[model samples]
Target: MGPPALYALLMLAVPLATIFAYTFWTQDGLTIDRTLTFSNYREAFNDPLYRQLMLRSVWIAGAVTLATVMTAFPIAYFVSFHVPQRRKALWIFLITIPFWTSYLIRVFLWKVILGYNGVLNTTLLGLGIIDEPLSFILYNANAVVITLAHAFAPFAILPIFVALEKIDRSLLEASRDLGETHLTTFLRVTLPLAMPGIVAAALIVFIPTIGDYVTPRLVGGPDGLMIANMIQTQYLRLNDAPMGATLAVLAMAIVAVISALVFLASRLTARIWA
Candidate 1:
């Protein structure tokens, strides 16, 4: 391999190796020793709290992925097939403009909008829509899902749009010539061609959402907490490095397995289409 590629691999290898070693190693309250053990993993599995956190994380991430993809597909479709080529790039850029700012700021903006006395509540109260501010809108699992979905929407849109743009216009016309309805053409041609982009978008959103700590920590209540939040607590507040490392490793494993399943499913779908 080239020197830059070798150096990049070496850099990644060092930290990953350290994390793996740390997860297996034993630790006291403050210090970790290099003694290998499975006790940390056992603790993670045995703890009902961690299990719930992990399940919630996966659920939230899945929800975000589904929501973003469902919402993005239509916008991407319009941009790719209906909009003029000259305006397509501008439309896509406008869609992604929110991401130019920090992710934390964007999520926090949602918090402000959803807060009990925030914009929505103020407008509603001023217009006499409700007597009291809505507390359930923020600081919940739903809020986390919504906020993360908004944050990841652009990531989902750009890839799907690119995939749609890459498809040959002739193929779509040919499908129509064969007496296929628009819906049938979409199902048989457009969707299959867009699979790679859909997979890419899913990975971009789901993987990071699974490990996201910011949105959950800022807006999520106790029940909305994810595995990443717990992992952070273990490392910083609890000062249990081994347990924290264990949670990190578990999160990585979960992401890896889910990603692999997505890849396999996509391949299977492609094979069936072929």
Candidate 2:
């Protein structure tokens, strides 16, 4: 506890405290003024652009979380329940093959696949599926969601797989023996147990996706830009350290609130299942 606590204090708490302190100060020319002020927060809340970006970030992150979890669950279920025990590790290894490449490279590949004259449109054109290439898939919120969902799929799958693996086969068998259908057994005996993993996967995908500037910057175009993009602009381009810190703090607070809500919901669901 001593070493770990010290490590956290230095690595996590120190940086966060510094950022929090920065939010109260102002930047003038090249100098960071130590004068305490709440003007940064005021501007963050009052500005319509910042509000829109914040809302958009949350919406995109939520969509990415939902898509990733919904798709990953079935894959995880197949691997955990259907794959031969001896091959489970191999399947998991295959699932992580995407991580073997750099994340930036993966995002770039998705850009190519979804681009106007890219692989998907080319294939569609070759098959005579459409007269022209579709423009909606690559440079908008749809592209952001698609890219993030693919990128985070493995994170969602592994947790749900762990939860599914921990399910007692006897309980499922007993439920079946008592005349329950497979669907009923799954609903009553399996899903509640898997909720923890689902929650974990959701948080893992949502938190960072909200903060991701790269994917949005690369493929999100103008419409797909998020709060992180704004933060980067304020901090780097505008050289407004206080405003950037304020945005970062606000985003962190929003994520914290949402995470707490998810945890509470999990507890409530567990109690209901009990």
Question: For this target, which candidate reaches the highest TM-score against the unseen true structure?
Answer: 2
Residue 172 CA displacement from its true place in model 2, Å: 0.2
List, residue by residue over 32-147, the lDDT tens digit for candidate 2. Answer: 99999998889999999999999999999999999999999999999999999999999999999999999999999999999999999999999999999999998899999999
Quote the lDDT for 28 in model 2.
91
Q: Give the poorly placed runs of model 2, Cα more than 4 Å off.
A: none
Supply every candidate's count of residue pairs whose N, Cα or C atoms clash at under 3 angstroms.
Answer: 0, 0
Q: What lDDT does the true structure give each of the candidates?
A: 0.91, 0.96
* Candidate 1, superposed: residue stretches over 4 Å from native: 124-132
**Weakest 10 consecutive residues of candidate 2 by summed lDDT:** 184-193
What TM-score do all the candidates reach, one by one? 0.95, 0.98
lDDT per residue (tens digit) for residues 1-274 in model 1:
6998889878988778778888888777567777878989998999999999999999999999999999999999899999998998799889979978998898889989999989999999999999999888899999999899899899999999999989998999999999999999999999999999999999999999999998999899886899999999988898887888889999999999999999999999999997
Clashing pairs in 1: none
